[model samples]
Target: MAALDEIQTIVILMQENRSFDHMLGHLSLEGLLPDVDGLRQEDMELTTYANEYRNRFYWPFLIQDEASVIRDPPHSRHLVQVQMARSSSGKKFRMSGFVDSYIQYTQHQTEHPPPMGYFDSRGAWMTSFLARQYCVCDRWFTPLPSDTQPNRCMAFTGTTLIDDTDSRLIPHREHVFDWLNARGVRWRVYHDGPPFFLLFGRFHELVGMKYRPFSELAHDIQHEDPGQAPQVIFLEPRYFDFFWSDEPANCNHPLALVCHGERLLHRVYTALTCNPEKWARTLFIHTYDEHGGFFDHVPPLPIENPPPPGADFTEGFKTTGPRVPGLLVSPWVQPGKAFHGNLDHTSMLQLLAEKFGSGPEDYSASVNHRRAQRIRSLSEALADAPALRPIPTRAPEPCPPMPSMKRQPRAPNERAFQKAALELLQHEGPIATAAKYPDLVGAPLTP
Candidate 1:
């Protein structure tokens, strides 16, 4: 085993949506994802409680409630209702997609339906990511009943909801950052829009350990070339720009998501390779914040893990949800090994804390339950000194080069841009919109 003292840096990349099966189910099998399986699209499908037909398609083993079909929380009712409204009112798809349709459908708890484009075949991406990097804990899970915000907070702090009303509410629990500060480990979060502080306030000390917009990161990697990158870097995909998709862009947009993810990893690989002295000990991790309502056959058992309950939100908080997928890329991890050990969000935080010698109290400590097992460094996976492999580094792609920008244009005569836009949009279509305004662009152009 490589000595722990040899490790110096850790980098984390957390994307949105996608469950394990939705993204990695058939990965182990060749030509399976492309094969047909009756009405089941040869691919994975999200389960729903409202529809018996939909729920029947998932892994029967994972599901426990026969009548209460599993539906991804934050349902899609608002989305469907809005679409029906536009059809009868002789209106086009609304540009105010967030309020009218998209967000509502994505944010509610409804029955399972066919795989939305965003979730088409994320398994391909997950499999590829694991085969190319490292796979840990197949049973890894999320820590909340909600989506991105809460799950993300749990990841960083191993706690429950930050705010019952607003996910933006930052938790005060001591996190991995606290340990880093004491140990003098440096870090930062590269974003694309507002600083994380705006949404997370006082937690800035933890989040801001290193904070910069995605664009800023691009500039630094290409131009500034900071002699030393942050010890721990969190790279968030540019929401609309890099992860764009038509069907409300859930989590499955593998072409865009995987492409962007690979490109980003390539950069990290490059940074490490260019400066072997620094990269040799660095570890890069790429994973999802939560599974957007896609299908998963594996029923998630409620693990006894608890975060600093109510420490972030209401007192007595507990994690109640399913698993999310993750990829660990480093010399220390067993390359291409799929760890099927049962785990939850706290499990990951627990592993990281232990790897860096961060006290358990900083993470799993405040929580109550079976303490998650820490993952040991995977340095032995490499034959020689843990050096960054000489791999090709694809740089940050330009706007025009992005698949989202290459969407086919609407027919010249199509009215109600929504009709035109919706028609033009698909699972992996390009993201081309003449209309720059979010509201005006997607609304029906017709009267």
Candidate 2:
């Protein structure tokens, strides 16, 4: 096997929610703006509702007693968005509200809201890791107007809500996996459950997929060969009751985002650094699918163009949510630097396609076509100096195990939340869902 420095594998870990500023603003270590300053005055007012409620109104709930009640009332969906937008009123764009707000807008009805705060905090763990260890894109944004499926598509396919609105629906165009397959690149998608979109339909023809359950992730990594290991890897967390697991000790507990951050750092550090042959050449990119209605000050860039081919959604789309957080960690990029360049999910696809020699057809031709001077590369995000050698030979401390969780039979209210979400998904279908949900905006599911 070649030395770790010689290999160029890219491992991308994309989580679900959180805007760039909400999570990173408090990162005092980066000096990225510890306390609000003249330039950082654009931060969202995290304390807007703090005085009204002592318990910290991190997630917006229409009724004061939201945590105990899972019942998503008919108006809850609409109100969720309104409340989220209000919560993030300090953020830059008026259109960028919380997820529930957008959900109400897209569904054209009020409905139940899911556990936003719990999921976001968990996802931030991955983002914080990238910030501490690698280069961060402070100005990075999402290209699509709304939520997970389309934004994820942008990461892999380099296009917006073009083919399927629902993430569950498969796309017609080939994805990054196709390019990797054609190049004979070894890659895998590691998830707590079943593989998501990147592994669907014809796309599967191009890449390998595996279901290791959270319990098996580390064990699987132990057996990997530097040369035989996947060239690219993706990690997705499972969400249930604002917690990935149902362990009482770990259930819906409040924690400093940094705590979660440390955990994620340990995982990536081990995955790459442990295998001496894979550390140097590996590029690990961490980002969120969309901002889940967190307050952020930056507004989405104006995209005045028709949706690209194979795209089947409305155009002139605007996410209207606060800025989602993004980070890039690689040997080629500088450390402790914040890139203020304007980027969205499409940029991730652009980066991967270029690095792996994929064609532009997989992405929006408009963005990819203007490669002359317009194309911005993440190579600048690489660390100025390569990671120091003598890859430490520490006894393999196991990847932090996820607390065993039991999906207890859904409670009455929990069932309501799921039903509302399913109905919302069914009504909106795939394409509409992709177009409507943006980071930092909340959407309520309707019955």
TM-score of every candidate relative to the true structure = 0.59, 0.62
Poorest stretch of ten by lDDT in candidate 1: 409-418
Best by lDDT: 2
Residue 81 lDDT in model 2?
A: 34
Clashes of 2: 46
Q: Give a tens-digit lDDT track for model 1, residues 1-447.
A: 253456666667666656655455444333432221111433233432112321332221222221233233331222322322222454332211212233355454333332322222232433354444544445666555445556666666655444332322344466656656666666677654322222343322422336565546545544533447565676655443221234222222222334444454454555544554445565666667665554343444434333344554343323334456666566655554665555555655554555555543344553425354332222222233443445333334422133333233232111222232343333213332221113223434232
The 10 consecutive residues of candidate 2 with the worst lDDT sum are 247-256
* lDDT for each residue of candidate 2 in 238-260, tens digit (9 for 90 to 100): 33322223322111111212334
Candidate 2 lDDT score at position 87: 28
Q: Any runs in candidate 2 off by more than 4 Å, and if so which?
A: 1-7, 28-129, 161-168, 202-223, 239-265, 318-322, 358-375, 387-447
- How many residue pairs of model 1 clash at the backbone? 35
Error of 1 at 26 (Å): 3.2
